[model samples]
Target: MPVITLSSDIGLNDYLVGAIKGQLLTAMPDCAIADISHQLTAFDYQQAAYICGNAFGYFPGDTFHIIIVNFFDQHPKRMLLAEYNSQYIICPDNGILTMITQSKPVDIKAIPIPATAKSLLDATKLIADCIKQMITGKKPDTTEVKDIEEKYPMRSAVGTDWIDSQIIFIDNFENVVLNVTKSEFEEIRAGRSFRIVLMRNSEFITRISDNYAAVQPGENLAFFNAGGYLEIAINKGNVAGLFGLQRYANASNMQNRLLYQTVRILFES
Candidate 1:
């Protein structure tokens, strides 16, 4: 059965996702519809890219990914039918395509969705139209590729080095994800010890936790997330919302304008 995977920042509140699946089923009955995520931060392209780029490959070949982040904004209604590593993606021409394409040889085709459709609902119908045609063994009518945009995989943009002790992303747990990779942090350690400070007001946690359980229950501590980024988190608190920490592509409140301020990663090396 053909599969459709959905990724979006749209929370599970409205009937938007349900309506999309209903439309898809209307065209292709018995279609396997899965969810990459519906909890991505709104307009956070970095998080979307990370979630999609990392997980899309895990599914079977030719799975269609519908990404709705920043789609209906003031930007042009440029949909894309992108094929990378045997997977099909339908999304806006926003830099997301550039990031997900990731140097891989992809067939980028423009889609004139808004022209044929009147409103966003119509646009959704158009998207269903494209997917249905593709699933029915027909080549979807897609526009030619235009100019390419630069999509940086990391938050700080491309061509820039990750600074030591730099904060990266904030997770749902309010855990601050630092840009410093395990290898980078290890190099800086060089057998020397280091301490982690939270907001410079709380007690300084001197020990680096190898796992989440390193800290006492309900006690906030620092550690590396599965992606190997350093994370600052309360054992059980809305650290992000509580501390005003922004997650994934959100700018932190720092004077550098280059660095975010929610949780700064300072080192003793």
Candidate 2:
């Protein structure tokens, strides 16, 4: 049986998630299936990319990853099947595949969506059928899919003396993940001292902690997380609630303009 993973914005609140799984299982009995995350925010491509990008590498080679978030942002014409890093990515042709993987794939095929396929469940059924064909060494279409849409992940706006990074993610613990990775931080620092200025520069963290214990309980700290992005947190504290930071959200709303804030790093020569 083939291994399949699912990532989506459908969440688990309803029967849709279960229905998707049922389709995949009915297509291939005894097939191993896993869930990356089903509670992802809809239309938040950057956040979804951050999550799916980090997750896909952990699965074994040839595993098919089906991402269903923002699957219908446009008229449904065809689906995408991309071969990348020895794995398979099945997603809608909504320009988000590049955002997740951050690369252009040379091998991609278009899996046509039948006119009868009107709902999300119908799409999953199509994907399930395609997977069946693939394992038997077949493709829905042999012609390479060209002229597909593409989008890149949002990167921090860098300055020579400072770096401004958005709060791309906020974990269950309320710890914040910035867009700036460890290597990006080091490249900008250049052996200079720096301060992580937050909340309109009202608060500052002068050093990166080795761990939560590096600071006293309820105190703040900065560090590179396992994913290599800069993280801001407090020992046994709710960093987002306390500091008023939030996951990337509505840019037009005044509150979200403040909530969808960035963590600033100012380098001192």
Candidate 3:
């Protein structure tokens, strides 16, 4: 049976998610439907990208991943159908695709939206139709998907003695995930000791723990998460809530924003 995965900002509290699933099943009754998340922050592509990017690789190669967060970002006349790493993704023309993959897709096409379609449900049905066609070995008439016109998530700012990063995601347990990866940290460290400074140097973590059990129940720790990104957490506690760390949109003056906080790693040479 074909597998279809859904990630969306449409919370489960409403009928929209069920409606979409019903539409999908109506088209292909035997297909398996899985959900990545339905509580993604509205219009926050970075968060959606982070979650989908890390989760998509674990599914089978032919999985069809549908992302509906901020589906109207550009009021696009067409939706995007992207084939990357042998998986298929259908989402809006927004930059989330590039943000998630960190590169341009090799095979992408545009699925036209009818001019009369205004409601989100209309678009949802269109997506279902597209999936049905793909499952039957039929290709829709489409144009090449274009490059994103806007900026995506920022890379870590590297300096001689420090790597400046930001909190990309904070999970339900309140553990903080940074934009820096383990390989990036090691490449920059070159065997030098480092300190992870939190909240603009108010506090710091000096060791990379293996897991939550590596530290006492209330102690703070740093480690690479299953996604291979560096994370900060307090064993059996809410690190993000306690430290007041939150994810913010990428802006030119992001540092000056009221809730903005940058996670810095200072390497001792």
Candidate 4:
């Protein structure tokens, strides 16, 4: 049986999630459907990319992923069918694809949608059809699509002594995940001591911890998460809520950029 993963912003409070699943099953019965997440924040493409990028790799090869987060970011003229790492992804023309892939996928094509079709279900139908073709070890019927929108994941702004990063995600426990990866951190450290500054110079985590247990309760600690990103947490406490650090979001406005607190890692010789 073919495996299809669904990641969408549509919450499970209503029938829409089931309806979309029904449409998929209607398109191809006997296909196994897996849910990656349903409570994704709409228009929060950064977090969406972080979540999907980390989660998609664990699944078996040939898994078809249907991403519905911010499906309406643009007019529904067409959607994108991307084949990367032997996995197939069907998402909107929005930049989430590039953000997740962190690069422009070489094998990408455009799946045209009917102009009259203007609903998530409408897009689901087309995606379901594409999966049917892909499971047969063939390309979906799509047109050559170059020049699709691109949005890369944010990275730390590096300096000789400091690296300024953003909070890409906060978990249910309120541990804040930064955009900095282990390789980036190590590259900047160069075997020097470092401090993870949260709000001000007065409050900081001076070293990387193995996990939350490495610190006393309510004490702050920093560690590289399983996804290889820097994460800040307080043992048995809420880091983001207590520190007033919000997820990174910039409307391209100066004021909008100030809404979230950035994670700055300072290195010392």
Provide the TM-score for each candidate, comma-separated. 0.77, 0.94, 0.93, 0.95
**Which residue pairs in model 3 clash with each other?**
none
After aligning candidate 4 to the native by TM-score, how far in Å is the CA of 122 from where it should be? 1.6
Per-prediction CA RMSD (Å): 4.0, 1.8, 1.9, 1.7
For model 2, residues 76-112, the per-residue Cα lDDT tens digits are 8788999999999999888778988888898988888
Candidate 3 error regions (>4 Å): 146-150, 199-202, 251-255, 258-260
In the range 85-186, model 1's lDDT, one tens digit per residue, is 888888776678777666634578877765555555566777888888888888887777856454655532211211334344555556676655667666
Candidate 1 — worst ten consecutive residues by lDDT sum?
155-164
lDDT of 4: 0.86
List residue ranges in candidate 4 displaced over 4 A: 137-139, 256-260
Residue 249: error of model 1 in Å?
6.3
Q: What's the true lDDT of residue 65 in model 2?
A: 96
Off by over 4 Å in 1: 100-105, 153-169, 187-192, 201-207, 241-244, 248-263, 266-269
Candidate structures ordered by TM-score, highest first: 4, 2, 3, 1
Q: Tens-digit lDDT track for model 3 on 1-269?
A: 88999999988899999999999999999999999999888767777888999999999988999988787766768778889999998888877778777788878888788889997889878888888888899986667856644437778889989998877888889888988999999999999999987656577899999999999999999999999999999999998888888776655576565344567789997
